[model samples]
Target: MSQETAEPGIEASAKTAEIEALKDTFRNVPGLAGAPMIMAPALAETFATHQHELGVRVHPDLAVKKFIAPFRGPRDAFNPSGDYGAIDTPATPIPVLPNMREYTPHELEVIVGQLRDMGVVNDPEPPRDVAHVVTD
Candidate 1:
């Protein structure tokens, strides 16, 4: 039997509205200013652009950690390199690789533990059984 579904345009518009509402809600919060997930389009961009303007306090959530980890530093710290107007040559993009790094399993565990301490990655999902065989 055929089932009725929302029109693609309507669905898209609804999703857009929902996203806007979420953004508005985020903005209303006391903190989370310049948060990448709340404002930036992609995870990569978020990692690159989000500044930790909330001082030393963090929201203790995965979204905050994922976005803020790369830009963790004093908000008032001035970057001489960031001043592009004084430069005569074209601005060279800072390599994104600086923010992206591979972590070993032990390193990952340490990171997870740190996040846990900060209440960021609390209540992680239980590990699944990978040894089970699939049967038809």
Candidate 2:
């Protein structure tokens, strides 16, 4: 099976979570030394260099938590981070971790690069906001 089978088709995935829950989960990881994931290349690079302070932060469960944290909020369309989201409300797309959707050119490029580095494959026509790159 291709990478698409396990992840999303881009235009068909997206979900939301609770703010308090998300904040709590990350606060409770055991060996929270480094960043398990980074949306920005600069941050990822910084944490990569300082692996001690940010060690293994993204375990399977925590990884999923971090992925959904950005989506916790109102039930309207709104982008959490102007850098990672597009248009107005990002609630819909933001909640959909590991899904797909219409991402800005920059976001797409950066995410695509990260996906490649993380051993994740690219799904051409990803379902809307149900897509994200994950490590195997």
Candidate 3:
């Protein structure tokens, strides 16, 4: 006797559709423009978690570059004033990386806090108290 395999259920199809829709959404979210590699489980998980509102997987390697002249150059990379700011400053090369890892929301918050303390961003405060209390 020959046996026939069962087709996938509606639930599986629906889940697949949902995942596809999420992939589309992930593509549109800014700052997430990177190749999606299936072999990288961490990257895949991270992309899904941050972009799909799903569980987070491993943290992916996100590349970044910063101005090197100010941090490292003797104003040597590019003289914005001298060159009329026409030339772009050279950026620092990639820094040594640690084992790929994931960041919890709490860890992210801590990183953000440290960045703000380092003046990378401004602290959230009441907006200048723009409105006068106007107490008589």
* TM-score for each predicted model, relative to the true structure: 0.23, 0.19, 0.23
**Candidate topping lDDT:** 3
Q: How do the residues 4-123 of candidate 2 rate in per-residue lDDT, one tens digit apiece?
A: 443454333321113222233332133335323223434434433455334333333424223232435543213222222222333436454554566778988898899888879665
Q: Write the per-residue lDDT of candidate 1 for residues 17-66, one digit (tens) a residue.
A: 54443333222122345322222234323332233222212232423211
Local distance difference test values of all predictions, in order = 0.41, 0.41, 0.44
Order of the predicted models by lDDT, top scorer first: 3, 1, 2
Q: Please give, for residues 22-136, the per-residue lDDT of candidate 3 as tens digits.
A: 4433321223344222223344345554654554222213313212333332342123211111124465444454432577779879888998989998977875646667777
lDDT of 2: 0.41
* lDDT at residue 7 of model 2 (Cα atoms): 48
What global local distance difference test value does model 1 have? Answer: 0.41
lDDT of 1 at 83: 20
Model 3 regions lying over 4 Å from their true place = 1-93, 96-101, 128-136
Worst lDDT 10-window in candidate 3: 77-86
